[model samples]
Target chain A: MHDRISSLGEKKLISRIISRSRSVFGSSKLMGLGDDAALIDAGDDYLVLTSDLLLETRHFPDPGRPRDMGWKTVTVNMSDLAAMGSRPEGFILSAALPDLELEFFDSIMDGVIEACCHYQAPLMGGDTNEADEIILSGTAIGRAAKDRVLMKSGARPGDLVAVTGPLGVGAAGTELILSGKSTEGFEDAVERSLRPVARIEDGIILAESGLVSSATDITDGLVSELGELMDASGTGMRIYEESLPIGEEVPEIAAILGMDPLELALYYGEDFELVFTAHPAGIEELSTMMDIHVIGEVTGGGSIEMVDKDGATYKLQVRGYEHLSPA
Target chain B: MHDRISSLGEKKLISRIISRSRSVFGSSKLMGLGDDAALIDAGDDYLVLTSDLLLETRHFPDPGRPRDMGWKTVTVNMSDLAAMGSRPEGFILSAALPDLELEFFDSIMDGVIEACCHYQAPLMGGDTNEADEIILSGTAIGRAAKDRVLMKSGARPGDLVAVTGPLGVGAAGTELILSGKSTEGFEDAVERSLRPVARIEDGIILAESGLVSSATDITDGLVSELGELMDASGTGMRIYEESLPIGEEVPEIAAILGMDPLELALYYGEDFELVFTAHPAGIEELSTMMDIHVIGEVTGGGSIEMVDKDGATYKLQVRGYEHLSPA
Candidate 1:
């Protein structure tokens, strides 16, 4: 596979990616993209580093579009920064391409460059190699105020539950793709699956306002992510089913696929949307930047409950990607 | 591929890698490895991050041997860290496994763990997915003392050239492998090609000594790496070919294959040895380390030359791996 990929000139693709990346930060970087390794400036504080890998058949859906694949790789890590309430500074991209076709490779880079531009984060450095399947990995670095970083373990029992943006669009769109259905009129819904943006700006704003008590991105479905937040924060949450904001295209695709819209919303993964907790007083301030709906409230019990519109309540069940679950 | 990988239990090979990682530096890291995002101890310093990819064919040999493949993955990045003279504290291993067997994956981890032990680095995280070929991408983080990290551009015209160990054994052994020759009595030599080790300790020592002016690992052959050092430093060098250290096992393989030993030593890549430049005063202290040898001298000529054994000189050229070079 490496030999097959070797036929494609990696340096050319890397050169293109580097040229497209703009340096928004100052001149402290001793070396950036295009070098064998990157050199950065570190002062008195500790440096934060993280790396993520997106396989063609793992972090994304099979038969996934290539441009979306590229976008997903970058946004996922950016979402990590959002969870930490860190302002992204730069990231390093490493990709293993199956072939060396310049046109195909450029399209992938175009998607990556677009995300970097959208987030105002520069491409610091990267590695490009060839493999049988397309593999993308990124290491992102960000900065945060000393006492302002949000954590998954900081939620209190009385914290208000909120999420940035609606749910289920990405998973619903993916269901359509699986059924050989057209997504022409539902570009936004499909894009939610392909190019879901990370809520970094919202996270930073909430953190700076000293309003957010805890934060985590919804990579897994809503219920699964909520479970993680609950486990981490040692508190349960009570959510109202009617308050759930379903995407416009979600119900249509869910109906066609014979899937429950609420179930789809609860189980849709890779949304890269932020689910955070704050005090009731902080809710109005956070809603100023974007409409953050109060979906629920943290409870003392260690179980999540959903109150249906029929005035019945039940334990929320999560069914999504679990790292240890059998295939 | 992404869907297939995502569907597979996350706790398979990659989670195992991450589970072994230890965060020794601090306690404020909210997210380490398990979550979609990692929360780091983002203090005052700008984070230092670097990544390198190991391709089975380009970085190692074909028909990959699992242990060496794993070792090469770690050593390549270690060399990158050595170039910057940074102490690698953490790494994220992202891999695309061609085969998901326990034995094959275990052997790869054995190699990575060996490297971690040697460098005193920890595997803080990783991502795994399936591919047509085996791929390893490692993102390493190290805290350098302020901005005092060494770079390739630190060399001066009056500096002395040095190498950590003998070269060409790896290349010669690889030649034997490619030619389907017998590995009669040269187990050590064959191991050089298969299990190349990086000069991480040497890098740390040299960085501390503050003697080495510029440094880079011999990944793209001696001449190519030297060319990089020259390009970065804007200076040239004159290497005494007679002074080159060829491993004892290298000569036997060279004689059996009827290849020029000197040419093999100079142009053959994948040495993973450290090639550095230092001041004349540091030579005595450098010799304290085992096998440290001064093989050349830096000059203002902006080109590299080799002075042969018979009082003859020739311009050394780079025929090492280039992405666009004809295979």
Candidate 2:
């Protein structure tokens, strides 16, 4: 096991897999692999496609929460489309299921249906197979104006970095679930974690506003995702730590778990919010239409650094839940 | 275990999953569930999407042959597109890997890349996660002329049912693998099982010819697939038992295993061949172009029956490998 893929870590393994030459078909791949989502060329628009896998043991914090798993699976895929600033057209799923109670299966599907309904991503049919574990693979297709699509590479020095909502709910809720903590006033955090919303509307609004420079949804921790934006754009981001919108329950949950709320906000991930950079003028205009939190600014430097209210700058840790890596 | 889903069978389970009202999203689904492949309406063409799951234990005859599994995974998805008379646009895959050897993973991806190269379905890169087993979910996107797309419900009475090529190779190859038999002269059968072609060119030509009335790809077996066409079109078929293009190796393999080649040809699925119904005129033209096996004729009767060379009729058994059921 030590010599297995886990030792290589998720990033390395993915890099290795996608590093394979993509020139398979004759036509050029507009955008596939290594991007927020795969984009296929249409006449006047681009087709956004993304896929995510959720395994029972790997993704499900508690085995009894099949419904959350279903919702999260679909939401995760949609989140990728949101990152690319597209509206979902349809959903395709392939599930490897185990022999389980009918209610468990039904509950999972109910959550899947509910999420698909809420997101306007119609559930197209998928394949099902008997397996040792519940393996859900979700693919979502969406469309956006060819010119309006967001990429991770367009951020500039003057662009202001923003997020759609508070973060760390997923990390906090998962902690509470694993710890068997009481679900008292922390229900919001748990709800957000179990049923995170894809920022589809905000993404579309941002892309159409033509004010945004770059964008990506925060599936991985903020720092990790920001790293992607930074690396892709060949730029850096200077964060105002005080401006970090840590979840309401994050403080209490961090205290309860003896962790740092800022750490949860910056690195715990699972916040299905959009982290984007846009012109200040566009932010002022778009802020009236939707909630926007300007947390940082893109910079010319090549490293992501966070500045405290006291003016101390520190390199942010790039850590999140990486698949195929040791926990 | 007795109360597990296996008791429900693959057909029942799939029907139950897809039976959920596709009215989740308001925009009418072009062809989401219960179709050969889900179709999304574009300007002048339909984008076809299909996803299939291949489990390590269930799909791989020899774990050492990760290469074959990778190839089959892509080929199977393309096979669905072929059934719909669509050409490959791109391929997306989500692989759930366990703590695996790098060589094993590399070989699987190599096969995947090679197949994508061969089929002109560019690799659009997908997700990878660590799991308890190697669970591969492959989704293929294809495009076809909206007017020329084939459907299972279009076969009318008097149509001739034809196949792209011979059958039973999948069955024989699998038997050879499972039986650990010497594959001296049966390499072709084994090869077909491992690296089956997705009849894409033939399907496009058939669809464009406007002679095809109905079609489906053989995955569950010829009889089961034919039964699907029969049920969907509300028409029956009179298959000539003598005309079945059973692989030449099937007879020897069957004799070696003390089994009947006809049973293997009829019931053991995974041939990946296209079973389509076309007009007699189209068949004449298509026959001169590509390999076409005239197996039967669509009838107004309600049951699929086989007419032996002896002139006796018998109901073709509709049994194939059903997932989620005791094999």
Candidate 3:
């Protein structure tokens, strides 16, 4: 029944987005995100190719800041490549703009540009169109060493679980922002939610170690993603609730909202952090380069369970957004 | 003022769209169109990657037919790989659903599954999320013979212009459907518009011939795509209007709608038809295997013109969607 939206006039918006996206990083890019197509070097065997679509209303809050939306699109796709243990070579940014304002697109692309430059990734090629709504789809191509690519099925029982950054901060921070709470002294938490950086460094380091078992990004927060890892590997996990690295600001925000801090940390989504499992010996070396916290261990059971600080354990329900769940 | 529009709930609709896409193509796909990550094969030396985003109000008319939306998302990306003259291997579909419903997404994926089977393409992996409106994005991977690939810049002046199928039907059919005009006895026109087939076979034949000067799909329409070919090669072209192989039903529809037939034929987008320039010597051979049409010839100067029935020639203006134009 929704027929009001039309692709009438959005030229200015598309231009603003395209111009700001000109800034990209990396050396192997023969072309970067402006042409009908982007070409890359697919060395020897294969190239890790991925394209992700980030909608304004679904991926982030509708009234969310444009900078965060732009940053999240690139970061999420980069996280996809990172999970594959690949180094980005280039990306194609296809944007469908709803409005034609320079300010609107410039702010969004500013975040995208910053993220690409930070990750040493370059925009390779993409399409841009004027639609009734804002749509950003990115195709990123990365490379990986032949024998070292990690996968979800690589985790084994007895493997130690670790995370690259503190868990639940992004969801907690977003909850605060959505509720109109002040983020004056909590900029880090807000940034964690808005511009949650992909663990590119950790992905590379983990891939090279040869001992890390498996890995994936925690975009859907800790509970959902951890369960995914366990499902993929055909193993169960026992997590320690007290061991979660909740952001310092989360407690303050939770207290302000009179919400349960643990639930905010557990159920909220869009973390963009990395959850990985490896041998306990690798933690010391990994901690030198990243803020990794040992949160759990793989076990023989068929389900996931979390033990609270009070020495009580409970079954972790599959409560996050499941792609196949009934509406 | 648009802040309220931006803050609407979108991700809530994606679950319905993705659920309709489960295991339709029959594969042991580690993941397909819902998970945070997808695992696929690392085939040979190269992977063909293509992504397309179809907006509900912009790309299609509302109340948006979910079936056509789903089908177009998959076919459009498939068309890109076809433009590259590559064989379909696998695809990952990501979508933003406006709400939770099985009917729309199911019908759409039904079209997608049919196309995949028709082309022998497989479903590999993807992600899904709900959004404020329906936006379908698909990433397709194909394998190409490294050195045998064709590029848009390969076209040279003096080459003969060719197209794979009839044009203007898609635009006309969509107009009929959207305008509430009767599609009775216009079944071909309706199919052409709702589900324009990608020139996959012609692409293969063209690639194998080693004769195509340069190529691209008639996405933005005949005139605009030809402009792209000319822009890339730094050449111009002249076409005889009477030589264009318009579909038989196109004229009838144009007459009923009281619109210019030639204009509709030239400027209609989403044709998904292939247009290429090749050496005159390959004309006879190429005509046998495909529905090849010679509408014009490439000129030394970088301009495009069409000769009317009266033999008066005029410059052809590009009138398709311009990405950077101000809204």
Candidate 4:
């Protein structure tokens, strides 16, 4: 008795597949599935491996320039390694592309090369094939000290929840592009959406400083990421709606789009910012070292609650970026 | 100027991409792009990384069972590492699938799990997305002793060229399937094509014995692989047509299909067998250890020739599986 994958959804389908799979390396693997990346013991350090897939019309609806698409492809995979607090080592890219102009291929590769150079991660090798549309898959490998590796399952109750940078910038940028508005004053938002940077250095700093108890990256909105952290850590969270670190242009863009600024900050994803939990005593030190804002506290229960400024509380919905759902 | 990708061809397109991309790791990387896989120096051993893309129609035109497609997907990437004489460790699989029956997804994952278990390569974490068609990408990470890794650019003149197993079986299998012929006596050939095995043990044996000077797996026919070995080693080859290893059912299948068995042996691809070069003295030992057939000898010049039984020589055409070619 089989059901449609659309009915199961992406998350349930992945969980089913992972449940059916068995681990070949039991002892040597530090972390296996369900984490941002897999970690294996490599003698002196832990090697991190992660893979990401981006499809045309799905990941990038209007991938304006090929170069930007290439850059985003690598950045997305690298973001996983950043969540694990690993140093970028290298990546192998496999692309299934349609018959396009050579200039388009060149532009896409230019973006890939530029991003590699920027991150100091070399392009090792890859495979290319012909397909109906552009589908890019990148597998990034990195290494980290075993003691300094960050995990989502290590949060404790009462830990302060924080973000490395402001949220909703990527979502605002997406709005500008989709609305066909001039990005004169919203350059920062558009750039954030088009070229989101992985917070690799910040993750490393948090992990090395022994400040972060649990960490994950905000690719699928703040609430979604917090839900994952809570699921992994077996903890709940109390988030302050007023404490959300929203970018300056987010509110203006939200007003223009007739959307709630707080809703955008809580729901819009692809920020690629590090969301981590730390002890309250270390919050000031973390803020002094980097642009971090305390937004919540890990609670004892297993439900997420958002408190408004007027002392009203609402249960945050678990909806985020879901793939394979009917539009 | 914009040119169509078809005119540039797949190989040329890859070359252009590799030329445009730069290596971020200068001294630490043992091998970068343009190899079976990239080799990076770990602390004690070399880490091998490779990625391969498989599309639904392009890769598996008649992917009879979902399990077979999944097995083939992982097998293809493992074969790349096999060419490098690296031991299989783990792999990350990223899939972009459309809304399909749950049985299809289950069968595919079953095949992937079975292959991983068989190869002892654990399944790490990966990304899944929705697409118009089924697209699977696998990135396999492996390890090898720094001195024991095989490379394509190490063959010297007078080295004997050999293959691990019979050639033409995969081709004959394809023919049988395409013709809808009976498989009473051609079961071996059909199995070869449907479930080809990667010669991982033979590769490791050859590498550990210090016998193989250069090696690569036969995924794109014998002549194409030999051509790559020749180009990488800066040498030529003289192959004996009578020495071509044809399977038992190949001749009969060729007779039925009105095709030349020897031509199929040279041009048909997806064998997943190891082709290597070594000194004449080591050939006998290698043959004793494995089912290796001596088919040719490396020469000083840069051209490939095939000598028939009657001593008539013909210049072998550089025809292999070329993707995106105008048929």
Candidate 5:
């Protein structure tokens, strides 16, 4: 208790919570915390439950855009369910709002309802309280076949590591907004950032095909999510930087901001895309169904390394989310 | 859009949300918003889910007591489940923490774990974020037999109204702290406020016995909760003021503060006790198992009235929780 939480870091603090919260009545929990979502054994189908918190100025780039804030709040929670290969059943929104206009509240609710309609998830009831700032906590529940539920484990060497779609657009969107740059040419980046959709269909396909091994959503950057998958499966990834699907607007934003597009793709998170490892044959079949980028291969090596077009390899740094800090 | 949320008030805003959020995903939702908890129709059993948010300065009387804060966060959510006669299976904490000491963090976790153990609910998983304030949102998931699921409906005229336990201690505790009074003579009141436990067993017994017609938890004062029950069940209540089991220190604290003890019991809430209506025979059977106070009878007159010791009858005021405000 004397040790500062910042000294321990977010990863270690999360580890501490996961271990300490292990309770006695745990017969029905197929998977507890620390994964994309927790799993409960609900007879025939496993109940997939996941929650995510979003603060107004902390998570969003603008305080005036309540609609986007509301949209992202639901998507972030559903993305965890998607990462688990589960179909979202319902969403529970827990909001703490400060004093605000009724119009802003409606706009936020409009965004929430729009997302619910898009995801085909019901807006279940929620709890509300008054606070100094706006904080949205969304808990999404989904159901997946007991056998088809995915986790951040079971990856084996020789499997192909792939992403459901491109990366960096979300980061670019964030960059553009933070930099106050006009979105004249890079509107897609801002759009992707505001209305990012989870790869739910791809995750379900991966689970049903039974070809995928370990999977996680790329919300906290590729390297960080890969670190989680590797830790859970006792494996590492050898990523080929050249094979990645970088967003069309990523390079332009990087050039304007004097940042490397590759760096944005690798470390700047909030993409909400699926990263999975599957057999080569499974990758081929999945490619026929939907677009995917085979960016690497699973390996027994204990460290994550990336190989560039020049065949130069270096360690991929894993910087866990920079949210929590010590007092 | 032009109206302020505070101008609309909490009740109207909540009603607007419930109506507007009616989504396309309809099946499997036994009960949606506007109840003690939401119910999902899982195959053999109903999955009960509820969430309650606590703010550092807003909800707690003291921000220094993290343990009580944690304990109350879990209890308040579980109280919702208890109102529905559901057995809590797991508790998920959605914490938006600030730059606080690690010791404070651990102390909160300790309280969470302690409550989970007390209620026999596993600490499932949770989502955490760093915010400017400490916002603890606790979500509890429970399960109950589909037939025995209780809701805020189904009361009938001539039914006896009862409470699982005494009231007013929690309000007394709040008054003492806010008034900055010494607790030397009112330690029990403060204790009750800091450590209120939901009447889970009583709710279950009332549900399983098939005698109780309706139930709701007294979290927002007896009158407020009773008003909810009345509105939902299309019946009013006739309470006997002399029959109420006021907490031991309620009158003493009221005397010291120059307030009525009955006011604390009637309008001051946070008791986490069950208020249910049932048949007289069932009350007899339940009385043998546990102590209960028969406080009133359900009436078809569509008005909540109370009979005092002097045979005076008057309308019982329903002041809903005063939290939300217009910005």
Candidate 6:
């Protein structure tokens, strides 16, 4: 009689939703649920649509700056479009607020505007409502060339897996904030957590070059993202533990928290880095254009494994940021 | 130093938000923040985008069914697109949920899917997150011919104002719910409040006829909607008090609750009726097609007034469901 959403888990909930909802647009809908962004055929290109929600205390705890919250809300949705190799066009926001100071609301709007300007995404329309707590939702709409759109289900068995930037910065920043530590030298990590930039340019370049076979953004940690790609493409992956591009300060921060740097880089989410599969020749070409680390390679089977320098492999756990699962 | 959002009011807050956000798309954006929906040029047609938020206590109190909540959420956003005379293409939802019963979540999904299927709008993509309370946000995307889309600013002097259907049923339903009265006899009112329908067909018909001068959905009741149209078009209105198409049961419900039916009809939000302006010939033609009532006429001045049968004119107050304002 276990019928609660918590028992079903987030993935199962999503699957149930997809199963119940049928596409009415027919072939005009290029992509639907279970993808990074929904794709709709728009004559010359495919329109990308995605949404993300951020709640108070859950997404950002007390003493969190309002501007940061606003910026992060917009950034999360932008990251979805970035994963699809779509150019940021515009976004609409729906926010619910409790009784609060006008300065707080102003600061949040300022942050959202800053992020929109930074990404060159215009603020199109929005709704404001009253609630018991602060909740922000943003939907980003973008466009990409019909053939150049990146997908999570396009990876081949021999494709090389790579990341656009360093990992664990977001986790490190969260730890710093929760611990109330001064971010003097770890400002980069703090910034990464508060105002992380989506890999829009990198995705566009990779897509246009036609080098990347499949792509996804690492918002829910590295292993979880790889698992999604593997699940969608019906392929497995072998990741090298030492090949992860961990930030220099991550080790020190993890040490202070009495946690392993590698574990932090692996399990901690919200990194917002592009994790993609590319052909070896494409990887060679992309390496010259941008800094990308070859962290893994796609395999034929349906299991994700991590190999250490000692030539031993361990099965990777499928644990990341699931919404309704038991903590 | 009084900087509370409540003091600034919802209108001022929206103005502040619009002032801070700049448009990046330029000419391609046919319409922006202040309209019912944002319009962007998409080659042959214009894409209409709008978003709405629904919170737990603010939008729906306890004893409310989960399916109704989901249905209302989608309906509210669809109303926005309907006001713009846009055909709904698809929608993306972002929901924040607390640890709740599985049946509650399932019921909500059922309601949302029901609405989407009824409207022929597909559920494209969504994000789910954890929160302290249930918060749902939906972004509706639609398409409309560039020249045929109705706008709030298209009203001209001498245009006749009309409403598609009866009003005050939503208010009557809310009153019944708050009083815990039996809904056996007032089932229609209860249904109106809980499962209000968006007038999508009426909007499409009016837009196709090319006769309606301007259009807006009465989500915030009749008075507030007229105020918006007046403000946007720089025109005034003179409404005949007796012309309001009040629901048959609203008067009885209002009398039982010791309230005036006219006041309830004027102020109660969530009616979801289409309030629009048309030429006299257009009104004559439309009256033959649908149940549209001629309630008022557009004037030259920039003030809205209600004229009684005795020829006395009273300035109408712009009070409706405003968020973040004093209760």
| Tens digits of per-residue lDDT for model 1, A1-327 | 223222222222223223322222222332322221232334432133456677776656533366677677778878877777777776667776564344455556667766766776565554555556677887777666646666666678888999988888878877777677777888887767767888888878876888888777777678877776787688998888888888878888888888988877887675667788988888877887787878888888788899999979899864454432333
Candidate 4 regions with alpha-carbon error over 4 angstroms: A22-30, A258-260, B22-32, B179-184
Candidate 2 chain A weakest lDDT stretch, 10 residues: A21-30
**Model 1, residue pairs in steric clash:** A56-B1, A56-B2, A57-B1, A57-B2, A57-B3, A57-B5, A58-B1, A58-B2, A58-B6, A323-B10
Q: List the candidate 1 regions with Cα displacement exceeding 4 Å.
A: A1-46, A56-70, A177-180, A317-319, A322-325, B1-47, B55-71, B98-111, B130-134, B173-185, B190-195, B255-260, B288-290
Tens digit per residue, CA lDDT, model 3, A3-74 = 211111111222222232232222233122221122233454235666777766555653358877777788
- The true-versus-predicted C-alpha distance at residue B266 of model 1, in Å, is 2.8
lDDT (Cα atoms) of all candidates against the true structure: 0.67, 0.84, 0.67, 0.82, 0.83, 0.83
Tens-digit lDDT track of model 2 for A63-140: 788888889899999999999899898887788888877778878888888888888888887677888888888889
Chain A superposition TM-score, candidate 3: 0.81
lDDT of 4 by residue, B29-118 (tens): 536477788887786678888889798877773675788888888899899888989898887788888898988988888788788777
Per-residue error for B52 in candidate 4, Å, reads 0.7
User: Residue A201 deviation, candidate 3, in Å?
Assistant: 1.4
- List, in the given order, the native-contact fraction of each candidate: 0.14, 0.62, 0.12, 0.71, 0.57, 0.66
**Residues B242-270, model 3: lDDT tens digits:** 99988788889888988777877798676
A1-327 per-residue lDDT for model 5 (tens digits): 366566766666676777787544443552747788877768888888877788887888867788988899899988998899999888888888876788998898888878887887888886667777888888888888988888898889999999988899999888888888787888778878877888888888878877788898998888888888888889988999889999988998999999999888988787989999988998999899888999999999877999989999998877644567343
TM-score of each model, paired residue for residue: 0.79, 0.96, 0.83, 0.95, 0.96, 0.97
Model 3 has fnat of 0.12
lDDT score of residue A186 within candidate 5: 80
Q: Write the per-residue lDDT of candidate 4 for residues A1-327, one digit (tens) a residue.
A: 667888877667766666555443443442657788887768778888888888877777357678888899999989998998889888777888888887887788888878877777888876678888888888888888888899988889989999989988898888778888777889888888888899989988887888789998989788888988998899999899789888899999988888877767887787889899989988878888888899999999798899988879988976566676545
Give one digit per residue, the lDDT tens place, for model 6 in B213-275. 888998877888888888888899889988988999999999888998888888777788899
TM-score of chain B of 3: 0.83
Arrange candidates, best DockQ first.
4, 6, 5, 2, 1, 3
lDDT at A149 for candidate 4? 90
DockQ of each: 0.11, 0.59, 0.10, 0.65, 0.61, 0.63
- Model 4 interface CAPRI class: medium
Cα displacement (Å) at residue A225, model 4: 1.6
Worst 10 residues of 3 chain A by lDDT: A4-13
Q: What is chain B's TM-score across the candidates, in the order shown?
A: 0.81, 0.95, 0.83, 0.94, 0.95, 0.95
Q: Considering summed lDDT, which 10 consecutive residues are worst modelled in model 2 chain B?
A: B21-30
